[model samples]
Target: MKLETIDQVAVIGSGTMGSQIAMVCAIAGYRVVLNDIEESSLEKAKESLEGHMERWIKKERLTEQQVAEAFGRIVYSTFLNDLKDSDLVIEAVVEKLDVKRDIFEKLDQLLPEHAILATNSSTIVSSKIADATFRPVKVCNIHFFNPALVMELVEVVQGPHTSDETAQTAFQFVESIGKLPVLLKKEISGFVANRILGKLMDEALFLYENGYASHEEIDLVVTKALKHPIGPFALMDLTGLDVNYYVRQQRYEESGNEADRPAKTVEEKVNKGELGRKTGKGFYSYT
Candidate 1:
């Protein structure tokens, strides 16, 4: 389908990324269907989105009426079939290949043949999941950073199977939503931004875990010395440690390299359900 043809958008999984992505599309004047398996999750997502929009109003980034109209454009649903009319579907579910492929396969069957399927995965490439759908040409990675509503840069990966039209449509759609789109001619495991950030995070974890310095000290050094807006550890917490753990796990499984394995601390926190801001604790405590 052409860029102009994309009207209604669907986002699967009503977690943080999914909710924010749906809001982004809604704010851009597209009717959005945000779907999850649980009605409770959908309700929670709506509540969270309202809170976010309220903050935007307070910050004067958006007016109350604009927020209301954006919210009105979004339809929260528990049924996958509700997405039948969506011209594009962005899957923001868990960072597991199996789960993503399952969603893509289902979306392939539910959505119209012309619908484009994109993943908001930060690590996994779209090609790995595109094969699950019959329309690999319409599949591409539209990786949005954490807090999709706030972040401006979006990485659009045009995999081998992705058609020029599909990649251009995704790029234009991202820009149409007011986000800057950087096109990757080829697909890599982490795309561009994350690959560089991942190395920094790896080193930070190594230093902290090896007793070179506390996470707090390392964060201070990065923020003060490197002049980064947020330190690696803090950023990981914001992004969710579970996401980092899963990403590392996926890498280890792919490379069979011990160094690519999730850090022990990250694994422990994920096992204990302390997944950063959402859970109130991760590398640091939010509560």
Candidate 2:
């Protein structure tokens, strides 16, 4: 389908990424439906989105009137049927394969034949989920980095089953929403950015776990020497240790490589429910 044909965008799962994605689409003047299973989650997303837009206004990235108009274009819903009319559906659920496939199967039946289905998963490739749907050609990966409203780079992965038209349209849709898009010709578990970031994280965890250096010192070196905006440990915390842990777990499960398993420290943090800023503690504590 052509990019102009994508007039309505539906985001499944009203979590951090989903809500921000919906806001981004709405800000770009697309009719957006933000769907979640729970009404409480939708309410929280609404409040969090408003707060996020307020910060954008402070940064002069958006105006109050613009944010208001964007909000007006978004519809919050708990029913998946509400997405039947969507031109594109972006699934931003958890990193579980079965869960994603289940959602895709339902979406395949619910959405119109022409609707494009995309996932925001950073680690799980769309090929793993696409087979569950009849329209595998319409399914592709549209991964947005954490804090989607702030991050500029978005990865659009074209799985073997994904049609060229779908991949190109997904790339154009991302650009139309004012973010940079990189098209991946092949499907890899972590795509591009996260693959590089995953290597950095593995080394950082190795150093920290082996007592070569404190996480803080490693972070300091990364920021000062490597010139990275954030250290691997700090970035893990920002994106949630649980998310990192699950991504690693998924990789290990797929490859049967023990080395791909979650770091010892990250597993411990997830066990304790110290996910990240959301939990008030992860690699570091937050207020």
Candidate 3:
């Protein structure tokens, strides 16, 4: 499977990151299948893609013709068998190891032997799920940041069994899509960006929990003083409290470290269904 032969991509999941990733691949002229378990989720993904394309056209980043072409390249499906012809499959489902492994196992049985399998998970490494498939050499992590269409950096991770050819091909694939690619020589739990961001978030949560400062004040200082575009709380809202909580829970489960537990505030917000901007409320109200 040469890079030139990789024209069909399958993105499994229609949530925020998955939808954006599908659009990105389509915009790069690949025929993309965006798969989800529910019809409503696929509809939402199509709507979101339409809005993103419209915004891009309005901003003159993409022409009407380009948007139309990209839109025409995407096919939404609820079945995993629909991805049988894909040359590459990027999984962007929830951050659970079992769920991801289940999907990978199914994909391995369905996709062609040459197809490459990648995950968009931030914390869960590829090695953890590669064993679910017979072709562990083809399994790697291609971590895309939130708002995948907007973010420039993508991490192409190599697991213990990931072959050099797979890593090189994944790197080239990401670069061909007009995004910067950074290779992770070894698989780390959080990779590079999240590890640093996790430290910052941990300290921020600690400060707020210990009553050393208010969440708003801490966020203000980070934005105004540290020159960050958004505060930690605001970022959490954008990323979703549920997402944060779940990722933390997974980390805690793996490490058995008390500090890896989700922050109380985040857990409470997720419990109340105030996920983030998508739900209209989190640390701050969007409604």
For model 2, state the Cα shift of residue 26 in Å: 0.8
Q: What are the per-residue Cα lDDT tens digits for candidate 1 across 236-280?
A: 889889899999999999999999999998999899998999889
Provide the lDDT at 225 for model 1. Answer: 99
Q: lDDT: which candidate is best? A: 3
Tens-digit lDDT string for candidate 3 (190-238): 8999999999999999999899999899999999999998899999998
C-alpha TM-scores of all predictions: 0.98, 0.98, 0.98
**Per-residue C-alpha lDDT of model 2 across residues 1-287, encoded as one tens digit per residue:** 99989999999999888899999999999999999999999999999998888888999998899999999999999999999999999999878899999999999999999999999998999989998999999999999998898899999999999999999999999999999999998999888888888899999999999999999999999999999999888898888888898899999999998999998999999999999887899888899
Give the whole-model CA lDDT for all candidates, comma-separated: 0.93, 0.93, 0.94
Ten consecutive residues with minimal summed lDDT in candidate 3? 1-10
Query: Candidate 1 — which residues are off by over 4 angstroms?
Result: none
Stretches of candidate 2 off by over 4 Å are none
Q: Please give the RMSD of candidate 3 to the true structure.
A: 0.9
**Candidate 3 residue 120 C-alpha distance from true site, Å:** 0.4
